[model samples]
Target: MKEKFLCWQTSGWGLSLLLVLPIVAIFYTAAGESDEVFSHLMGTVMATYTSNTFWLVVTTLVLALLFGLPAAWVMAMCRLPGEKVLQWALVLPLAMPGYIIGYIYTDWFDYAGPIQIFLRDFFGWHSVHDYWFPDIRSLGGASMVLALVLYPYIYLLARAAFLEQSTSLLQSARLLRCTPWESFRRVSLPLARPSIAVGLSLVAMETLGDFGTVSYFAVNTLTTAVYDTWLGYSNLNAAAKISAIMLVAIFLLISAERFSRRKQKLFQQELAHGDDVRYTLSGARKWLALIWCWGLVACAFLFPLMQLGYYAWHYFAESWTPEFRAYSFNSLQVSLTAAVLAVVLALIVNFYRRLDGRRMTLVPIRISSLGYAVPGTVLAIGVMIPLTQADHLLNDLAKSLELSPPGLVFSGTMVAIIFAFVVRFSAVAIGSIESSLAKVSPSLDMAAKTMGYASTRMLRRVHLPLIRRGCLIAGLLVFIESMKELNAALLLRPFNFETLATYVFNFASDEQLELAALPAILLVLVGLVPLVMVNRSLEKKH
Candidate 1:
């Protein structure tokens, strides 16, 4: 038993350390000097990068809350028409990448596009300075684009929090002659504040991590700066230093969020799963709520999706080239590989914790999960630092042995891309499997042990059967996340390699998003699978 515990416990810690190695390498590499590149960047574009990143995170969070909070409240509090469909439809935006939306909107709203042309002709305006129109390629536009997709994070959490609130507290507020709005403001919103904070943290982190939308819109943020600093300057150390800055910012953001909830002791009971607990809206109120919910769905998901469909239909022959086929296959191969590896790692560390519930056992799971919180671009740079070093060391060792150095094996191949994906998304798998495992009865473990079953045998026979559904869901979730991953893929892809994300991003960057519509549609359609599955699981849970 002691030997068995030693094996699994060390295995768990080893997996955690593998995930953490890149992050630690970032700090170590940042500690090294880099030919005054850091100084030049500090004197030049650093302030602009920092300011843009700050405002982008702040504005995007506010906008996400603006869109998400009201929808969450209405969904939880009211009986609306087609409530079931609307609830899931509102989350469809999570399937659409911000860059795709940015591309479609920028084209539609540009001067040469239909909307602007109609405005100009209808108002009898001439060419230059005839009227003012909102630009879809600015910082504000990037924030809106990001907020559209990311608001679902806030919406999901806030609605779950509201649903789980104590009915007694809300009733007391109503008994004291509080209006529905007043009861929500005084009793419900306060209880859901922590959940909102968590959601906001996720939104802000994603906004900070974003590369494609902001880059396409010509807004220079830290994520863009990191990309330019490395590729343009060819300075890995400087990029690592910048990534270290991003890690610091992430740490502060996470710490502040946790600190805010340190004293919060709120607990909630589940909301009943029927219409009796809901208030039915009528007349203009009903119409307004319906408009609020459905309007978001149309603008965020339906509109962009329609635009992509239109483009794909019109340009199907041009868009579906041999390269498109290769990129699609590449995306599938890489994402599926990452998903499987991530699930295996999650199972290893999570089951270790299941066996031993010590504080030390928990450390491996937590440490492994830290990779998800690191911004994708930052994680990419961190991944490069150690892997590049390993590649060089291997080459030198090969040369010393009078053998040909196998070139660019780790850092310059699919290994890096898939490794980064696994690290970035392992947390999603861990959370899903850990939650499923927590629901399994401990008595079953004891029962199996008394029946002369070893840990591995019991896990395979009992827990695996039970959590297989969770594992499938977890793997699918990771696969979709890997498919949608843009920032890291852009940074870490092998030479002459392009996933669907990077391929479409390149097309959008080169002013040819029309030609990119087919792959863009593929990205959106792939992402929708997990969202629907997750929504179904949530429904079943309730």
Candidate 2:
């Protein structure tokens, strides 16, 4: 029994370390000296990069809160017309990537695009000098584009917090003759603060990590700096340093969020029962709430989807070519591979935790799960640094053996990208599997043990079957995320290799988004599967 326990513990630690290896590689590489490139960046572009990234995170957080808080409040606590449809519809935007939305909106709002053309013809304006317009490729525009998609994170978590709040607290406030708005402001908002902070932290990390959206808008954020430093100037050391800087920022945000959550727990109120009294809107208030909810859904999900469908319909033949097939195949191949690997890794760590139930065993799960908070750009930089060195070592070894040098085996192949994907998304799988495994009764484990089953056989016979649904959900979530991922994919894709994300990014970068509309739409459609599943799960829980 002791030997088996030792084996399981070692396996869990090994797997957890493997998942975190890329992140370790990044910081290790960054610790090395890079005086020349670092000095040049500091003197030239670092300030602008830091400033833009700061404003982007701040602006996106504010906008997402503005859009999400009221919407979440209305949907969770108020009875408005079409509330059911609006509730799920609001979540649809979470399925769309920020970069895809940025590209689509830029095309629509550009000076020569349909909106401007119609305005010009209608108002008899001839050219740019005849009217004033906001540039779609600016920092402010990028923030709004990201907010439109990312607000769903805030909505989901904030709404869940609202729903989980004690009804008696709100009723007591009402009994004190407080207005509905006042009750929410004084009661609901405080309780939901930690959840909102978590959502905002996620938005901030995602914005900081964003490459395609910021790149499309010509915003010189740190993520773009990392890419340009590595690929444009061929300076891996500089890129790693920039990535490390971003990682520090992300860690600070995560720590702040965790602290906020701890405070929330300290002050949290327990509900006596699962009962919530929802307010019903009437007169002008009703219509206002209806418009607010539906308008968000329209702007976030429906509008872009309609545009993609229109473009795909007209350009299907041109867009759906052999290259498109290759891109689709590559996306599925990588996404499925990453999904399976992540699920397996998650199962290993979680199973070990189940068997041990020790504080030390839980540490590996926490450390491994931290990859989700690390930006994809940082993860890619981390992955590439070590793999590149390993490839160089292998080539040198082959040369010493007097054999034809095997070139670029790890870094130049799909291995690095897939490894990055697994590291970045293993958290999603771990969360899902852990939650599911927690629901399994300990009695089942005891029963298996009484029947003389070993730990491995017990897991295979009991936990595996019980958590199959969770495993599927985990796989689907990781699969969808892998499909929409852009930063890591953009940075790590080999020469002439393109996933659907990179394909759409390339076309959108060249202002040829119409040519890539089919793939973009397909990506959105694929993303819907997990969103629907999540909605169903949430509904079941509610």
Candidate 3:
């Protein structure tokens, strides 16, 4: 038993170390350089990148909350026709890659596209200067595009929080003559704080990590700077320096959020028997609700998909290639592998947390969760710098042993792509697993142990059965997340290796919207299944 305990503890620490080492490697690489890189960055692009990234984060956060929180409230508090379908449909956008959406919107809203063309012809406007239309490739456009795809994270969590509120607290507020709005604001919102934080953190992290959409729009954020420094100028040190700055900003934001939430107590008990208190909408209000739901669906799902499908039909028959098929296969293999690995690791991590009952594991768990906080390019750079060094050492050992050097295992290969995906998407699995594990009782483990069963046997026999549903949900979410991952895959894919995301991103960078359509549509289609499943879980839980 002592031996088993040590093994579990060490395994937990080792995995945690694996998670942090790459990030540490990134910091070390940046810090090892002299003050010259910092001064250069400061003189030219540093301030601009910092301002743009900060504003983008703030704008995306606010917009997502505006769009997401009310939608969550409506879904949780009201009964309407096809409400469940609408709820799920709202989340379907979660699967749409920001790059794809950015591409679709850029075309639709561009001067030559249908919307602007129609307006131009109708109004007799000839030049972009004649109309006061906003550019879809600006920072504002990136924020809106990001929020449209990411609001679902907020919606899902807020809905969960709204549904899980204690009926007694709500009742007490009602007894004190509080309105539903007041009760929600004063009582339920406070209880829902943790879920809200989780949701907002996801949105901000994703915004920071974004590469495709921002790059397409020519937004000069750190993600773009990372690419520019590495690929354009051939300066890995400068790229590493930019990534380090982004990481610092991410750490600061995370710390501030943590400090803000530190004073709030998150514990709350659900009523043993309580159903959602549904409000009936009146005639005009009913139509308003319908319009609002459909409007969000149009912007979030319908417009971009229709645009992509239209282009696909217009171009695919003429331009389909064998390369597309191969890239699709590559995407499937990598995404599915990463998804499975993330879910499995999540299961182990959760189990370890339960077994050890120590606060030490929490540090690594939080660090692992921080992957979602950093940009994909930044994280990819972090992963790449250290992995390359490790790869070199391994190759040296292999040469000494007279074995073949492992040239592509850690860098420029499927393994690295999958590792980055696991780092980026595991947070999704962790959330699902924690929720699933919460439904399981500890008494079963104790009872099994008391019956002379080993701890492993107790876990296998007792905990696994209860947590299976969570695992399924977690795996599905990770699969969906991997399907949509873009920046990490783009930067880290091996030579001659391509994924669907890389295929679309290549064309998007060149402004070849027509060529990018088919793969983007397919990516969105693949993402819909998990999105629907997550929505179903939310509704059923409510």
Candidate 4:
């Protein structure tokens, strides 16, 4: 028994160490002194990068809260017309990538775009001096684009927290003659703080990880700096250093979120009725609420979707080429491959924890899952460092053997891209599988063991059958994330390789968003599958 346990523990630890190698490589490479590049960056553009990153995080968080909180609270606590439809519709924007949003809105709102052109024509003011028009490429504009997509994170968590709260507390507040607003402020808001913090932390991490959106907007963030340093200037050391800096910021944000939740405790009434006391809006208030929720849906999802649809229809003949088919195939192939591997690895780690339930097993799972929190850009940098070294070693070996050197066979290939995707998205699989596994009764494991079945056999015959849904969910979630991923794909893809994300990003970077519309819209549609599944699951639970 002890030997079998040790073997399981070893497997878990081994996988964890493998997953964590990229992060370790990052810190190791970043420790080297690169005074020339580091000093130059610090003197020239480092401050701008750092400040833009900070303010973008701040601005996006604030806007997401402003947009998501009220909507969540209204849906959870109030009775409004079309509430059911609006509830799920609001989450649709989550399917839109921040970069795609940036691309679409920038084209629509740019100085030479249709909106400004129409305004100029109507007012007979063609010159720049005639009026003040906000640049969609500014930092503020970038934040709004990010916020529109990211607010769903806050809404999902905050709404769940609100719905789960016991009605007794609200009743007590009402007994004290408290109004709905006062009750929410005094009781509900405080209880939901931890959940909101979690959502905010996720939003902050995503904002930090963003590359394409900020890049298209000409915003100099740490992620972009990391990319430019490594690829543009051919400075791996400096890029690693910038990636390390971003990693530190992410760690801080995660720590703050965990700290906020440390003392959170919720008490539920054991036999409480299913009835929830909700406030009803009427007259102008009803219209205002309806407009507020619908407007968010329209702006975030419907409008952009319509724009994409129009462009895709108009450009279909030109855009639907063999190359586009290749891009789609590459995306599906890589995403499916990554999703399967991630789920299998997650099952291994999680199964080990189920058998042993030891700190050794748990710690490894936790550490391995940390890659999800690391930005894709940082992960790509970390992954490239090790792969590049391996390539050099391979070339050296080939030279000694009097053979042709394989130049960049590993680093300049799809292997590194898939590895980065697995590292970044394994957590999604782990979390989903973990949740499903937690629901399975321990008696099933015990029963299988009593029948002389080993742990491996038990998992194969017992847990596997029960957790099929979880495995599917995990794969789907990971696939969607991998499909939409831009930063790592942009950094690590082989020469002449083009996934759907990279394809759209390339065209958008060149200010040719119309040419990229079909793929971008397809990406959005693909992303919606998981979102819809999640919404249905949430509805069933509520």
Candidate 5:
């Protein structure tokens, strides 16, 4: 039994180390000679890239807060018709990729698009010199696109924080002659700070890692710099250096968030019926809340989705092709494969933790999940370094053996892409499985063991059945994330291979979002599956 347990622990630690290797490889690769390249970049584009990355993080966080905070409060503390629908509706925008939103808005607001055309005719302005319009292809536009898709992170966290607030304290605030505004400012906001801060960190992590939207807008950030350094300039060491810098930034961002909340602890009771104490708003207040909440939903999810649908409909003939079908199939194949592998890994690590409750057993779980903190572009660079080395090693061995050299079998094939996807998305599966496994009481394990059930038998009869739903959810989440993944796919994909994400990005990059609309809409619809399932599951739990 001890041998079996040791084996399980070894497997967990080994798998976790496998995932961590790529990240370590980034530094190893960056450690190669690159002083000249570094100096060149410092003399040229590095400062601009650093500045854009910094401000993009700040601007996106600010915008997401502006959109998310109000919506979270209204949902948590107000009464309105269709409240349930609106609550979930706010999260629907998460299914829309930032690049898709950037494309849609840019198309509409461009010089030749309908919005500018209408503006030109309405004011009788003939040309660009006659009017001023903010470019949707700028840093500000990329931030807005990112905020629309990402604010839901804040919304979900802030809403949960609000829902769990102490109702008694709120009532006490009311009795102390506090207005609703004052009560919210004094009590709710402070209480929700921890959750909001965590959410904002996630947003910042994503903004820092974002490639498609920022790249599409011609806005250079650390992410784009990594991609361009590798591909455009063909400088792998410089790309690794950039990736190392980004990783440092992400680490600092996370550490700062943790530091901020270290001294703060809340012992408030969870209010199961938090909604019972919700303020009843009627007349103007009700209208204002409704507009504020649903208007965001309209702008974020509905409007962009409708625009996509319209474009998809009109361009169906052009967009829907055998090539499109092939890429869609590629997406499904890769996503399904990656999803299954990620879930298997999640189950392995999570099951080991379940069986061995030692504090050190948590190391694997923590290590396995670290991949999620890495951005896709950086991850791709990290993934490439080792795989490329392995490919070269294989080729050399084959040559020495007088065998046919299979070139780039590991690095320049679907293998590389799938590995990166699994590394990038395994965290989603691990979180879902870990959360689900925690719900199964330890007593059940003891009971099964006493009944003479062996470890495998116990997992089969007791754990697996109970956690099957979580496994499914984890798989679905991984699948949806894999389907939407653009950065790793963009960087790691083979010469002619394309997933739906890469396909849409390629077409959109050519200023032909019209031709990409079908795949873009397909991507959105696929992404909605996990969101809808998650919401339904949360509803059941609530």
Candidate 6:
């Protein structure tokens, strides 16, 4: 009875409040506004935004699968040396913000950049029309930049699913003389389908939520359209309308993910076993495997870090200022707070769901995590609309109650910003914590209870002690995510607030890459620590 009550209070109300608040707020704001805004949006940017957003999503998804699957396959199936290191190294790119990659790639591939410049000098071509070259700021360039940074989500999840396959299953295939590639296609891909779906879902969400890269490349996706409506047209009503459209799109995606995973099951093994059965790769194939792994790391991690380093070296002597200190503090505070809070909320929700022993938890937990799916600008609008309404409602309540209203909860405060982070990132934390919880045998809980320990004690003394590393991983994932978060912070931050990401964004928006370089570098550096820790934790578990 007590356990059920706890579940109701935490997952029931707390999570329920979070789940419904922004949604309700959005509807209410739409209702309060006139229908004239919708007509205006439909006439202008709506069709263009919808088309661009759809194409970008499709392009990014296709590229991510193409680039991510082979690498995941190579690292997981082959017995190549450094394969262990490659598994962890694949996650390094998660530390780099998508926009930062945009900034670097734009410069690196521009006509005046080294690549095109070298081509020109080599061929003795002088004028712009002398040679044909693709523009890095095009829709195609946006897709490539996004795929490079985002494929890690696919790689990590797919690799885990690949590794988790039973050796017995593969051995049976080998008895029939099936090639490893054939076996992977027949056995591995089907079994690994769930993880691939999950990874693809994440990629889709990140692609949608992206603002910096799309906006930097002048790709008029839905996110950038929202900005134009709000800032350029000075029409908040039209912005809210478009944002609501985006919210519905995200909700549909959440529904689709739910439908896909509904019938899927995770096969639980009865015992622990080490993966000592290894196959050898030789000669040309061996070199190919090593090259594949190194090449991915180069594209994902080394390239971006080197670019940031070069920019920092060229610009640091001029860009450093006392303003950097204030921005640094803001970034650290927001990232740490958001990461901690999101992880804590996720722990409570996961525990309640576990105690109840219902697969239904998957629904709320997944939906709560859908903040990742909604564009950050759209999410900010969703969050801000509700917060502003809540503030207005509180002001009315204050007059009626003759007391102060709880205006500080969200309006132009850290509370609103942090709440945005929780909604956006709780999914990542839940993924980590749920994975840790899955590893802990249920018999341990039963054994602890039989020893006269209650549920609280079991969690504190047993589960927490065992899953400390997972909690660290979950927290660190949240931290890195928050460090690069831009759209939400840009829209929801209080007047005069500046985090490292937002500070860099302001400079980058002015086409001042030299000025943005320091904060961007710092953002990547801070993000790397948590990312490295996540990779290390996963490796230790393996």
- Mind giving the per-residue lDDT tens digits that candidate 3 earns over 1-542? 55666766676567667766667877888887556655787798778998998999999999999888888878877788898678778888887888888877887888788999999899999998897988787999999999998999998898888877777777788789998678778977778778888899879888987888888888888888897777777666677888888788778777877887887765666644445555677698778888887788889889888888888899986548899888988988998898898887777677777777768766656666657666779878878887787788989999999999878567867878898888877788887887788788888777887898876787788888888888887887787778778888878889999888888989877888788889888888888887767566655654
Question: Which regions of candidate 2 deviate over 4 angstroms?
Answer: 266-276
For candidate 1, write residues 165-223 as lDDT tens digits.
87767666767998878877888799999999999999999898899899889999888
- Using TM-score as the yardstick, the better of models 1 and 6 is 1
lDDT per residue for candidate 4 within 1-542, as digits (tens), equals 66877767788888888899999999999899876987899899999999999999999999999999989999998999878889999999999998988888888899988999999999999688999999898999999999999999999999988888888887888889998789889988998898899999999999999999999899999999999998898888999999999999998888888887787777765213477688888999888888989999899889999988988999999899999999999999999999999998999999999998767678878987989999999999999988999999999999999999989988998889989999999999999999999999999988998999988888899999999999999999999999999999999999999999999998888977778999999999999998899899888887
Candidate 3 yields a Cα-based lDDT of 0.81
Clashing pairs in 1: none
Better of 3 and 5 by TM-score: 5
What TM-score, over all chains together, does every model reach? 0.97, 0.96, 0.88, 0.97, 0.97, 0.85
Least lDDT summed over 10 consecutive residues: which range in candidate 1?
Answer: 268-277
Off by over 4 Å in 4: 269-273
Q: Compare candidates 2 and 5 on lDDT and give the better one.
A: 5
What are the lDDT scores of the predictions, listed in order?
A: 0.91, 0.89, 0.81, 0.91, 0.91, 0.79
Q: Which residue pairs overlap in candidate 3's backbone?
A: 209-375
* Quality of model 6 by C-alpha lDDT: 0.79
Tens digits of lDDT, candidate 5, 179-250: 879989999999999999999999999999999899888899999889888888888888999999999999
TM-score of structure candidate 5? 0.97
How many residue pairs clash (N, CA or C atoms closer than 3 angstroms) in each of the candidate models, in the order given? 0, 0, 1, 0, 0, 0
Candidate 6 segments whose C-alpha is farther than 4 A from its true place: 1-15, 31-34, 257-279, 343-373, 394-409, 428-475
Worst 10 residues of 3 by lDDT: 269-278
lDDT of 6 by residue, 1-542 (tens): 55534644465446846855675666667666566656876888679889988889889989988878878877777788877677778788878888888888887898778999899999999988898999999899999989989998888888877777877777778898889788889977988888888888888878887899999999988888777766677666667777877778777776787798898887744113555544588999999878877887898779878877777889887678888888888877888998998888777777766667767655666666656666678877778777777888878888799987666566668878887877777888988998899899989978997898866677899999888989998898888878788998887788788888888888877878878888888887877787676577567656
Backbone clashes, candidate 1: 0
At residue 520, candidate 1 shows an lDDT of 90
